[model samples]
Target: MGKLKKIETEIEGVYIIEPTIFGDERGFFFESYNKRDFQEIGILDEFVQDNHSKSRKGVLRGLHFQTEHSQGKLIRVIKGGVLDIAVDLRKDSATFGKSIKVELTEENRRMLYIPKNFAHGFLTITEEAECLYKCNDYYYPEYESGIIWNDSELNIDWELKKYNLKKEDLIFSEKDKRHQSFKEYKKAGGER
Candidate 1:
């Protein structure tokens, strides 16, 4: 058995994964992903896609989801740090609308698993950051949707000042700047 521990968060279907590292003068070694170990922890989905992204400090990426091809993701940071956020959007789930945040850094070597049907996003907390993620599904631009990062109703703490940043300091893709509000999304009939 690999040295992996899966920690459940307050939100159902979300998990924090820790792997035992062996280090010496040679450096450190650990299995980043083991199918058997992951399956043992009840994460059964087969991830088909891997994505890597590098963002500069004060870059806020998402709160994005897909109405049709929703994706479940297992994510970790390979360089620098980020405050990753996941929001439950399963209408029937008891924890619907609740969100959880996890700090991922290269030093910690931690991963966050967010099941399908959740909105996911993150803010770069250092000068620069690189993130790697595995997704159970492929991307489809036509079905992509997102909630505004600062949606008042969702009430996520982006920690601008804590990172020595103001909202204006954050950089975003033009598309992300036009995402709908959480309240408006629901009112328009969710998962449409």
Candidate 2:
């Protein structure tokens, strides 16, 4: 039997998956994604896009979501490790504005599943880290939107304090900085 660990939070559809790891003296092995198993477990989304990114410590990449085409993400660390995060941006959801954080490392071999309508981001815990993810929809550049990672309103305990982040090191795009706050977003029906 596979090991299933569910994190029940106020968030609507955030899941942390720790698949069964088979380890011997030689090494360890596990199924990152199995369609049959996923279906059995009710994760039936067909991932149509995949993305990979490499980042150095102190490089923050996001609180991003596509407005027009929401995407569910199945993410894992391939090379190093990171503190992955997802924020429930679905306005209609009871958990809207809530966020979940998880650590994905090479040794842990764990993956996170962020359903559609959630904003996703991560911080590198190691000097260098690689993140790979499967998406339910192709990335729509025009529809992409983001929120400021350090927005006081979200109050995400990014744990960046431990990393000694400087104002300049907290990188963000102009678009991200201009994103509406949680309250403003909800008033406009951010969820679809």
Candidate 3:
């Protein structure tokens, strides 16, 4: 689809996609994803799993990825908005241990494509937001791993206070809160 525009980030393989929108009195229309067009832009991986989640404001879902079955994700917001993030975990990569953040909102209609060997996460910025993503690999619970969202080593600039929320206001699952730090992830051999 000529409707798609791919924006490259500082990190290699990660991209922000802007789909051309046609608006009128009847509202708007845009192609979310077209395999051929996506392949044209280097997003040639085939998506095997589709996942959706809903969360309230101040809720943070991850900094998560699989070790043995690493996934490349194409993520977007279907309702409300979120601050989506991807952290490079490939030890051999020039940008390893670095992260990129982007805002995905229903209004902006932006999407993010995170390559495999990266940890992914997001924070809900609206009262409630629905996030949808396509994964190139299947989910394998046994291979799951994550880095603590607040790891000092990564020091992600979540800007939670800018959204009028304190760190105390953030809701996290027990698993997320207890995840290993980036240092620990590296110490463990950093397998992608």
Across 31-130, the per-residue lDDT of candidate 1 in tens digits comes to: 9999888998899989999999999999999989999889999999999999999999999999889999999999999999999999999999999999
**Candidate 3 residues 67-119, lDDT tens each?**
99899999999999999999999888999999999999999999999999999
TM-score of 2: 0.87
- TM-score, one value per model: 0.97, 0.87, 0.97
Look at candidate 3 and give me any clashing residue pairs. Answer: none
Candidate 2: which stretches are off by over 4 Å?
1-10, 163-168, 173-178
Model 1: lDDT equals: 0.93
* The candidate that achieves the highest lDDT relative to the unseen native structure: 1
Cα RMSDs, all models = 1.0, 2.5, 1.2
lDDT per residue as tens, model 2, 140-178: 888887776766778888887676766667665566667
Against the true structure, candidate 1 reaches a TM-score of 0.97
Clash pairs detected, candidate 2: none
- Those runs of model 3 whose alpha carbons end farther than 4 Å from true positions after fitting are none
